[model samples]
Target: MATLLLTGASGLVGSRLLPRLVEAGHTCRALVRSEVALPDGTTGVRGDLADPDALRQAVEGVEAVVHLAALFRTTDEDAVWRANLDGTRNLITAVQTYAPRARFFMASTGNVYDAAAAQPGRETDTCSPTAAYPASKLAAEALLADSGLTWSVVRLPFVYGEGDGHLASMPGLVDRFGLHPAHTYSVAHHRDVATVVGMALAGTFDGRVVNLTDDAPVTVYEMAAFAGQPIDGSSEPLVNPWAGRMDSTVLRGFGFRPAVPTMQAAARDGIL
Candidate 1:
């Protein structure tokens, strides 16, 4: 099993990923900012991306780096960029310094694409990410391209599972992102995200961008249901005509399938 360094090991996705990696026969060295219990056979290294010496300590002898750390939805957009972009630069530099041969895997977002595109985003489409959230991730993706590491980036859709409760905040998302009533979005379960990360680390997919999503686009009405609210005429027209739809053909080529296929199905089964 590979000894891998996992950043953001305590966040929503990170909390789920650590156990998934452990179950897959991998030993994880997770980076954290405070005292926390390490998973069985997993080590916790106290560090921050701003501290170079700490970064080196965290990655020492790790065969792979799954960099899941990110900053999101802050009031300050600049802080978002620095955390996502500068933090990534710091991590890659440390990897180059010590674990130079280690493979790199990043968790990115499909929101990085232009929402009003002509078609559902594919690996070949260009990115014109609008917000600081996705823009920072795009900058991080660029850093990986220059890092000289074998890297794989999986662009995830709206992730919900394991009591994520992200669906409960749709009112804020609607207002913040200017979401529209007819607007559609894609989604995936947390387990599917962990599965994709595992597959990427195992070299199942690399050297290209892959959008990991479910089989269909979900409507704002469905989101309203998940939020436990009624859909009113408060929404506007979608800015990105193709915002929520994505192409996952390459992901299928890796033999990865989503366990929860849609919000409705997830709700019926109590995953949403």
Candidate 2:
């Protein structure tokens, strides 16, 4: 069992991950911005990502760091940069000084890839971030590369399940973002996401940039059907062109299998 320093313990993925870490025999020390109780048996320390002293305190005697903290929906570009980029520098500095030998795992997004590509995005594919959220995440990945630490990054897909409202909001999101009915997107269940993190902590894939996604991509029409809402197909030009697909072969090559393989499976199993 290893001692791990974790950030974003209060968020969706983090809330799910903390308990699994404990059950796996790993001790987790969570970094929180407020005085919130962590999953039972784990410890919490109040801190912002940019506070070096706070990071230092939270990182003591840990074998690894799992960074799931990031700004995804804060529309302000500068706020996105500050949280996703500048805050990363603060964590890096603290890790260099206090936990240099610990393995670093960053939660990244598939959005870091070019959305216009013809094929599913792979780790070796070129990155062309189209928005502030992805751009900032990519920048943080660069910072981790230069931090001289042992690291691995997992680029996550559109995550859902465990009562997360992402799937339920698809119809509204498609309308709000001008998405097409035929658009296809890769997805992963929150259970599999937690499993992937547990595997990362076990050192299954280190010094690697792996994409974690399901085996298939779902079209927007299917998404609408799943949500019990029908949509008129292609009212606007398809803006996201990558087929919204990610190749998860590398992750499977590392001995990982998704528990909930598709949204259909999630809905049938009452997880959606």
Candidate 3:
């Protein structure tokens, strides 16, 4: 089993993923800014991604790194860039110096795609994100590509499940952002994320950028209804129908299958 260093161990995704990684028989170490309880057998290092010494200690002797930390849903552009881009650079540099041979896996977002795309966002698509969060994540991806490290990036769509309340928050976000009710969005369950990362840990996705999503895309109206916060329906023509959809052909070709294939399946299984 490989020794792994995981950043963002206390966040939504990381908190759920750490236990799975530990259960997979890997020794896990988490880098955190403060005291936080982590999965048993997973060590927590008190440090920030901006600190070189802390990162150096985190990466030392680790065989893999899963980067799940990111700044999302914030108005502070500088904080977003610093945490997403600059912090990624710090971690990459530390890993390069301390554990050059380690495999690196970073969690990215599907929002990096252009909003007016004619088709589902594919790995081969030219991304020109207008939002701060996705733009910062794209910039971070570029930095990792040039770092000369063995790395892979998984672009995640709307992630939900394990009582994260991400799905339940859709109505509020739609109202605040004036989102089109008919606009379809791709989604992935937290368990599916664990599956993809498990494959990455086994070196199945080395040197690749894979988009992770379920079998079907769901509309905002449906999501809002599912969350028990139904919103007004709009019959007006949708401007960005494919805005949140992603093509997961690359991931499928790698023999990846989402355990929770759709949001409905998650609901039926009582996992959402």
State which candidate has the highest lDDT.
3
lDDT for each of the candidates? 0.85, 0.86, 0.93
Q: TM-score of predicted model 2?
A: 0.94
- Write candidate 1's Cα lDDT for 58-92 as tens digits: 98899999988999968799899888999999999
Error of 3 at 52 (Å): 0.9
Ranking by TM-score: 3, 2, 1
Candidate 1 residue pairs in backbone clash: 115-240, 116-240, 116-241
The alpha-carbon deviation from the true structure for residue 258 of candidate 2, after best TM-score superposition, in angstroms, is: 1.3
lDDT of 3 by residue, 4-36 (tens): 999989888999999999999999999999999
Arranged by lDDT, best first: 3, 2, 1
Q: How much is the lDDT of residue 244 in candidate 1?
A: 74
Root-mean-square deviation of Cα positions for candidate 2 versus the true structure, in angstroms: 1.7
Per candidate, the number of residue pairs that clash is: 3, 1, 0
Q: In the order shown, what is each candidate's alpha-carbon RMSD?
A: 1.9, 1.7, 0.9
RMSD of 1: 1.9
